[model samples]
Target: MQNVSSQQHFILNGFAELGDLRPVLFVPFLLMFIVALLANSLLVYVVVSQRSLHQPMSILIAGMACVDLCLPVFFVPNMLLSFLFDWKGISLIGCLVQMHFIHFFGAFQSTFLVWMALDRYFAICTPLHYQELMALQRFLKFIVPLVVRNMLLISLFVSLAGKLSFCRNVMNHCFCEHMALVELACGSTAINNLVGLLTVFLIPVFDFLFIAASYILIISTMLRSSSTSVKALHTCITHAMVITVSLAVALIALLSYRIKNELPAAVRVFFSTMYLLFPSCFNPIIYGVRTTEIRQHMLTTLTHWKRLADPEALDQDGLSVLRSGKSSAKALHTCFTHIIVMVISLTFVLTAFLSYRMNSLPNAGRLFVSIMYMFLPSCINPIIYGVRTTEIRQSILKVLFTYW
Candidate 1:
């Protein structure tokens, strides 16, 4: 009641000054955003233009790619620019708009992820219904309402946000989030808080629950099949890993926002890394490791590229090269790459932990590392998944050939 009374008049405390480590934060996120845009655009091209990928799984992946493509574009560039220019000043109206889109996009992403879970569940558990139910037209019809509803809800909430006068605008995170913004509001924000709780907490939590339930059913159904337990387990493992990572990020973000005083800039940046960057960066790698079809396709594409690079090399020397202990060489290369990736990931994770534990490292370091870590998945996705996959390669080639 007292807070509400005082909320009628409020002045923002602007932390618009450049942080000490601004340069370290700017380059990687900019690069990552560029790569993510290109990779996801190519992914979209492969999924949509390729008739071979008109199937359910591919369609769902296309949706996911679209979401991934939008994620960095919407948030990262503005953040990089803000940090680089040392202009953390956000207009009240502009802040509201950003908050709206962030919520809409983030919510849409969670919704689509649930759809993916359902897609896999159907593919695994109810193969009979997959074709009929997951048809492109039918899926669009199902998705249209979700898109419309989210837009409406986000708009409504943002309008409410504009009403709340800001007591402070110095955000902990790079971007303006609903919870963070709301905390700055001088108004009681009881209604806005309720809406935030609903949008951020209720909606995603329910979707997560649904996705979890679908996976549980899928696992049960797979277990009963008894045809290939290993295959089922592999699929389950990949799904579980992504869900775990995403949920962990979401939980941490919620905690940081809710417990405002305790959380630092570095902690907020860490959450941003997990929530925004990790999924885009590591998704392709995770899919590549888990899905044999994707791996085989990638290998075929790589081999084709190698052949194309040296057309005449394939005849005598190429045959010899193919025959000359290819398996052992490939096995060695795979082992080395795996070891390197594992070591790098472990090292980076440890560094983050140490930075957090010893409050010595600045927020900029955390942001820079987060950006780099997130950059890999999005940047590598096109080369690792699309160019490497035979189906996508063939489709891309076919399109290029036709255009030429």
Candidate 2:
């Protein structure tokens, strides 16, 4: 074993255990990365380009989309390199950098979610104050502190990890995970562990509690109003779903980390990867499909594209056939398609979560579950949104046929 202190680079032993199966995994992983990248980028573009989307909620969504856009870039490319060419060596400084951004973005994501919850709380619980409270300038001012706080904390964590003398140069899982790197150190990691705990567990716990409290208040407020209750609850559904999925995956990842000895190496790796990847890929889909304003803007953009491609396709009001009206049967068909996609996505996610608890399950089955859990949501989300959302579907078809 080469001493990591003397070694210039650490070897990332990513999926080396899979051997020939690495290539098979590469394509899907690559596809997921691309889809997540495009989805998030498109979301940011839609929010930023449209002047009407400059509200508090849209600003927050755009901020999150930016974070999600950068989050995957830190790890996925390196993972792809490992899978395709078996290139797993990352420089020690590079490893530290990756650890920094990974944690930074992860923390930023939690911050964004908390703020989103607060945004909803204000919007629902106190509508009049929301405008004054969540103004763009004020929101940015609030976010700057949290952003700085995350940077400082993560920097300290990384600095503590970097100062450690490493006995070995190989990290067991993919990318440079903080604890994974800490575990490789030869020196006493008590401080590193403490700081890691503070950054990982304590900070996230605070965030989770804050988000929960916000929603509790939101729900209470909604219950008090019989007239606007249904509409208010509808507004919260997308934010609630994003929060649920993000925290659920984070909880499972934390569990996998805690019980690393009980689960197979691959299972642990997949859980951690899913935690990193899922929220970024899924959040945009939730907001895009569920949020009325953003969806309307996207539809408008697509309608413009349709207009350029074929003026005859749109009716007098510039509404395409798909947007003009949906038949009852068509509505049912779209609803069923959404339900099926939701069921499939949930099944894979649940299987991955359950696989860690079930020691009796075969390693290969767990591995397959993990792969599907990570891969399907990112790819499936865009397809569902693009296909089942009638306006988007028609616009896409118009563009495709025009180009063809």
Candidate 3:
């Protein structure tokens, strides 16, 4: 027999445990992929387009958004297509590629977290020297090591992994990863394990220590400089939230990978899938909500969208009795009743049609889609409160027209 089992292609049996539900799984996963891609893409465009948003903090955010955007584009769409068609086969070289990027992007995110912390520290603790300390040339020089070091570390890990022989040609999860591939080895995995530990220590562990130290110094400076304490805390709290959420997910992912074989297959699949999706999905949202500049850009962009969506949504609304600074029971009765009846009729007819269209889908699938329609306040709070009478619409149009 050819000894190709250890040298040839492998299979990625993504959520096959779901059986019929596997088809249903495609929608949510794809939806998450699309949303994360668009959200982060728009975030990057907003940061780069809006000139006033160009700052150290905004640049770091845009960098992170770029990472978040690329992270998903590399993995999710392929997984979705694979699941939808049940093509689990992955060539050996393809597996190597996937494994390399998964770790590379992860390490990039950790390095970025540390960079953001340093930016925060300089901004809050050493405000006067911040500009000199963070000059663009100096900052880019500093980042060279961060980018090169991680690439080399993950590259060494992937090269070391390529030495292993794999008799098992099937991955029992949704994605390709170092540890998952390591366990399929036909030879001693001692070297693989050592390299894995080294990679972990060099990337996550080292960056985490620096992150801890940065925060400790930030807090101490905040306390010692009592007058700026409240303002600094207010500014730093959002970064803190983003850091905590990111590290928590990373920790959980590490734990899950370690015990993946021990966990039930379904649990393993879900954790594997979600570990990739969650960071890509949430980081842009956190930054968009928490960062002042990003919030303003998003608000202005959405206001333009609203104006385009409904020209009369502003001062020229047809429903003028409510805006005339005078309201009577008769005006209310006439307008409110007609509008309510028409809306109810449209909503009923459309909902019934939608329900019929979705009748072939399972209850769980239908419920999932329905729940997603329930809008969250965190997603829209900026638009609701950031109304302005400035000529933002024209500016937006000009920028778009110029860029396009």
Candidate 4:
């Protein structure tokens, strides 16, 4: 009886330990993940489906979109399962796989963003050579190796990380992160941590330095041009906004992990946002604000979509509300209304589903959060830039008219 009771007690304690904080972690992450998937997917559509956006800059944007797209896919599903099913962790082999893809995609994101900055800097600042320098073939060549390099770099870290043995099953964060897990290992992790640090920081350092140098050259060149180049400045401003947001997040994540020992939980959480959230949320907005073509197309698409859904409605102009060119205010109002409707619809459905699964809500919510976070960019991005950008709208319009 004593032996049996002791074994039972040990099992119960293990269950209790895993249950402490994981259940409550679901909803927030789910909401964010959903937003990311929606946004990034829209970005991909706009970049690939619309021919006008086929420039080198947009091509690089497409690459970033691809990375963002893959990120949530890998992260959200695994995270959701772990959180919801009381399966709060990954096996050693499972963790190696997760880390490999996550780091590869993350590195790819950073590299692509830097590539975009260089593309813009050259186009805006070195106009004379821009065409010859980043020709289609060259752009293709430039990207292939960059992608391969990022994958290899990440692979190196993942292999090194895999070699380290974990004596403790405690993972503080939701995912199979490189440094966080390595820190928990009972084995000597100094080499692993050092390699992880280099993998995260060194490339970013080089990318940042290159971006900064490119911008400086761009600024110097722009200043020397005529006042008529105001449009160019506006373009730079948009690019700068995105570059700043992305670089800032990357820098913080790198710095935070480097000082992971010194930082608080809140700080780590903030760094996590840099990785999983900021890129999806802000990238579209930046493109919408700066790229007139994309913005116009998005607005046009939204208007048309609204009209198509409510074909019976007519505006004051006695025009089919769908086909009528809307004033800026009406367009803005429609956009807001669309967003509210979407949020409410999702909330309603999710709420009902959660209520039905009350006992498993926390784990479900956590899983949902992870999936949603990855999925977030996919859907929202379409509304923000795809529906708003006129050029994309026209392209779609052309296709519709031609085919239908």
Candidate 5:
């Protein structure tokens, strides 16, 4: 209640600077957010259900994937809601709540990357001892505390900032961040700034160095071998790739807090958003696809969906040819085009009939929906042929790429 009674609520200028263009940008951003959620969820499902993926490596990947899933839920939904109706008012308590979870999950993800890198290091360096060292029980013991410690430490900075009265309340970022609030304070912000920088160095900065060390040791160990297997080398390379992106994007975001004033507002916003968004979207795509076991399971699932979509597909194994017609996959795709055209024609006819008989709509509006159907090729054929097998069009999508 102290916050509500004293601290002022801030305006989250989330794309409001776009003026009229805010509405136009809403749909694409919403679509991207939804895709990230679904992709992460699918990763979790594949890891949990596939027995072959129960190893320590898959377990850690799934843990990171679960965090990536929750990280977006904290910010994206609110941003979507704000975009839809131009809501920028966030209560002091509300902003603090948002800031806490963002830091908590963001730090946890970086911490997980460090562990995953170490997992590879041990597996390669001490193959005999790796099993005892990275057993699932001992592994959880190492990670759970890291997450809890980070959450409590970040909470301290937010608590201190909450006490200082805010003379300014307009936060320019789409979401509430520690630095954004620190800059808005009325009193001394030296401690807040110091804590923020030190926290960045302590968490992601430390994680990056640890990851680099592990990989350096792994690479050095690999180079000493007489015959370094291609598969083992490939796995190490992919680990480096994930760690590089996760740290680089995170550093850009953390460093931007200090230099945010120098950059354009949009660029600052992009950097801040990408810090979490890239990890949420990229981890599932890279780790999920590169794991051979996960890739095979995903392919099997895709093949099943293909069969379900076309029950008449010639051979279930290959979908090689359609029935007796010797139709290739290209021909099967053409068949889907015909089905879509027919369904759309059916919808227009129903709408026209209902609107015409009711006669409630104005004359001009009715003509477009009702009168236009009579002139189209789809209506002409179905009405004349009346569902005969011999009357289907050879190519129902002739006008797909044309202006018509």
Candidate 6:
């Protein structure tokens, strides 16, 4: 292989070995990206818009959501292009920038998790001083410094990788991974190796230790007090779930990278990609489902939509008449519409599955099945819902006429 200049583009060998599975993989990746973007955006909006959620923990969660919102954009677009068009060439600068942001967000999240743990520690261990200790202004002061520190450290780390002379131009993974790029360098990478170890491994380990200590103290305090223990433990559950998810993905990625030679190329890539994808996609979902205030807020918002659609159907306590087993025409219409959409969706999905499983199936039939699987449900869903769902039709009309 010839040596590539820094000015040249590095080719990403993204899932090329998967052959026909590439197009099939595109749908889930696209769905995950959309879900991550929308979910994090919604979480941030909820925290910012609702006055009841203006607490320290809520603000930290919103901060994490903001980071999650940006994290997927760094790699998902390239992954989509790779899956669909097989366009995987990225310039050296572009690769470095992507590497920097990926690591930056990862580090930021790890550090922010520690901050959240600290918030919980203060809230539980020092209830009387919690408000004063985690004041908005004071919290911003702490967070701003950490943000700058991450930017500077990650910039230096990427710069060190950038300084190396490349002996190869092909990356065996989807995105621009740090050590993968460093491994392509021609000369000694002793400095890069050391800094990479520090930035990638030790820093996160330290953050994890701090978080563990904070939680230990929190649990000790909770154990000592019987009255507030349940309430305090409830409040910590969401953050605990978030930490577990983030650390689990990080551990998988770390082990995959460490044992890259033992693992298949696909397994390594999948684990690394999951590190970047899973937390952002699931953290807000965990919060939404587990946190009482946010869950109640979401329920309230859905109930408000129902009230807007059929005010008279809801009693004084906001319970819908449909819940009383009195089936209405509208309820029947919704059930039928849902059944039709489910049947159509499942039919296409099953056809797609059979095409992949049947060895005798032709490539043309497989391709057609893939296309139908991808397009049919998406194209029909909105039309079906708008036509059958009164709420959707009214919402569309209100938006159009209000804007007009």
Model 4 lDDT per residue over 75-107, tens place? 666555655666655577777787787777776
Model 3 gets an lDDT of 0.68
**TM-scores for candidates 1 onward, in order:** 0.71, 0.78, 0.73, 0.69, 0.73, 0.73
Greater TM-score among 4 and 6 belongs to: 6
Worst 10 residues of 1 by lDDT: 9-18
Candidate 3: worst 10 consecutive residues by lDDT?
381-390
Show the colliding residue pairs in model 5. none
Compare the candidates by lDDT and give the number of the best one.
2
Clashes of 2: 0
Tell me the tens digit of each residue's lDDT in model 5 across 199-289: 8888888888888888788767765542442334556555666666567767766777775334445445656877887678767766775
Off by over 4 Å in 3: 1-5, 255-261, 309-404
Question: Residue by residue across 239-278, what tens digits does model 6's lDDT show?
Answer: 5655665676576665555443444555457667877887
Better of 4 and 5 by TM-score: 5
Misplaced by over 4 Å in model 1 are 1-19, 136-145, 288-404
Roughly what TM-score does model 3 have, to 2 decimal places?
Answer: 0.73
TM-score of 2: 0.78
lDDT of each: 0.62, 0.73, 0.68, 0.60, 0.70, 0.72
Stretches > 4 Å off in candidate 6: 1-7, 235-238, 258-261, 302-404
| lDDT digits (tens) for residues 176-224 of candidate 1 | 6777777777747788767766666655677778878987898677656
Clashing pairs in 3: 6-166
Q: For residue 135, give model 1's deviation from the true position in Å.
A: 2.4
The worst-scoring run of ten residues by lDDT in candidate 4 lies at: 6-15
Candidate 6 clash pair list? none
